[model samples]
Target: MKRNYNKPTQGGDVRPKKALGQHFLTDESIAARIADTLSSYKGLPVMEVGPGMGVLTKYLIASGHDVKVAEIDGESIDYLRYNYPELAGRILDADFLRLDLAAIYPDGQKFCVIGNYPYNISSQIFFHVLDYRDQVVCCSGMLQREVAERFAAAPGTKARGILSVLLQAWYDVEYLFTVDENVFNPPPKVKSGVIRMVRNGVTDLGCDERLFKSVVKTAFGQRRKTIRNSIRGMFPAGVPLPDDPLLSLRPEQLSVAQFIELTNLVGSSR
Candidate 1:
């Protein structure tokens, strides 16, 4: 049975390549809700990543926001080009992860990003968002519920990890809501959650930004260990570990500011 991209599939195969993690949303209300999450960074063009069959794209366009999409699926690209002709030159026939995002928009151009993202690459997408933090002012999308929770997870929470700290340092993350598997065509095994992240007020972390990342990742590399043991290898054999009180706490217990302080301490020790 041929699947109509616009309507819900009763039971036929409506999925694109499973490798792409394509699960097209068929519920109009859910799509509209995802589109509505782009509240911040208005006036900037919106880029919809993995706009499979343009379910969410139509709502974004109707919302009067200037929209473009990065889609690598050939069939989906063809469908989008035909359905969303207003996108003319804006339908990027490229992979969102591998695209040189800085070069696509004008120099120093900022934009908002939204999507019902592919679950397989959701973490990579946010890491890419972080890499271009200066340009991507706001990001909102659907992801696996657990991953979404981690993005918006607070310090001292079990969901918090390297990304929780790294992303919190720059963006105000929020887990907006959850969606059931039945809302999608060829529903996935896990439920989904929508999230939004807007840039924060901190312009500078006041430490080696690279070292900050290293510190966060290192501290969580052995999440079961206390900070003192987790980061001990960062220093040489003779250099004593810092006597600070933070060393006693696990990485998840430290806030963003405390991580910065830890980064600075690690830098001084080196």
Candidate 2:
């Protein structure tokens, strides 16, 4: 089904909206390249977050994989439904962040997620994925270069932050390729990059997830401050000033394991 590119008489042209951070990707080559990255997982059901203009959707569907798309924009939904009639029922007109992904698959299997996400909520979307990491084997997305860098950054790097720690704990992140600003219909001011995150097996951290998150957040809250000072409140009975490497180092210097160790230490003392 081919979409009507011209604006409909009932609704005005839904050009890229700054509020929604909608930058429609018009470059076919880039779309194909993004689809190519998913070639290995041909039989898996793929959940695409924002299928703007059906460029990437077309490629995914053609690649012999079952494609389910979640598009928030009404105009894009109309366009997609009109253009790809076969994808009508498959396309979910709802926010990806709120949807229960595991329910979307028939066999109760996880789907590989892909999208050129809205920049405004990219971080939130990632957090959503992390919450349901068990249902996702792999994720590929187009994000602002800075955001992509954070996913693939090393523990001690400038790009490493709360996002890095959270993502790296569960996934092996890779920065694949960079995309220029000119590729979109209404080009964004900044460049974007493609990132792939493959889920690692369940970690054996042996600590409460909530406590681990709290400890990491506290440590990174005042990144420049020493761990001893930053996480003082996390331990009600007072955290022992450990002779470990973490006590002398700043938050950015500590890996996820080190942070988990700190949480375990705090939990043990309580």
Candidate 3:
């Protein structure tokens, strides 16, 4: 279905504002392609973040899915409600990060999340999704190419950091195709890419989560330092260094499994 781009009756004319990180996607083909990536799972409740002018929202609703949107921009929310009356009740005017994610779906129901996210807050939204993994089936978002690469980066790579370690612990991230800056109304400086992350339930690595987070943070806090030096104060004063094979490696060199092993060791020794 073709989207109605006319101005809304409720709100006056509003152009993309840099202050709100509003970059309206004008390319319908790119919008369709992003929609197609999430097409496999139809009939699932979809929570779209920053649905500027209902570009992707139009396609998602057209594909026979229940679509709800969380948009912070009042003008965009007005435009969406005016153009797509079907989504009037579903569209929420609130910060995506502040919304109650668990309340969006019914008991035992999982939802798919899609967005052409604001570059400024893309990482923050990813963490929100991570916090509510049980309610989410998967997530597809448009992010700056650099950020996308980090999400899909491998161990020992420079892009790998706290995000890689934390996100990889619970989700399998994939770097999809990249899109040019010209695709948006007011082009952004950096090229953007689509990223998809599917939840893989956290595994029991025999460690306290608090300790594990502390261990990972400390290890990566000084990436060049060995695990022993980086996490010196993590264990009790009298406790000896762990003999785990990974203790000799730098933070970037350790895989998720090795991080789990280190966390387990730290937890047990405490």
Which structure among the candidates has the greatest lDDT? 1
In candidate 1, stretches whose alpha carbon ends up further than 4 angstroms from where it belongs are: 1-15
Most TM-score-accurate candidate: 1
Q: Could you arrange the candidates by lDDT from highest to lowest?
A: 1, 3, 2
What is the per-residue lDDT of model 3 for residues 1-270, given as tens digits with 9 covering 90 to 100? Answer: 344556676324558889878888889999988887788789688999999888898899888888899987777876886789999689888999998888777575899999998999899999899878777888997988899888888888988877888788878888989999998878999999998888786655456777778888899899888888888788899889877667788888877888888888787787
Against the true structure, what is each candidate's TM-score? 0.93, 0.91, 0.91
Better of 1 and 2 by TM-score: 1
lDDT of each: 0.88, 0.83, 0.84
> In model 3, what are the clashing residue pairs, if there are any?
none
Q: Could you give candidate 1's per-residue lDDT for residues 1-270 as a string of tens digits? A: 342455333323234779899888889999998898875445888989998788899888888888989988877766776677888899888889898888887788998889999999999999988888989889999999999999899988999999899999999999999999998876999999999999988889999999999999999999999999999988778999878999999999999999999989989987
Model 3 residue runs over 4 Å out of place are 1-12, 201-205
- For model 1 the local lDDT of residue 147 reads 96
Pairs that collide, model 2: 1-83
Q: Write the per-residue lDDT of candidate 2 for residues 152-198, one digit (tens) a residue.
A: 88878988888888888899999999999998868999999999999
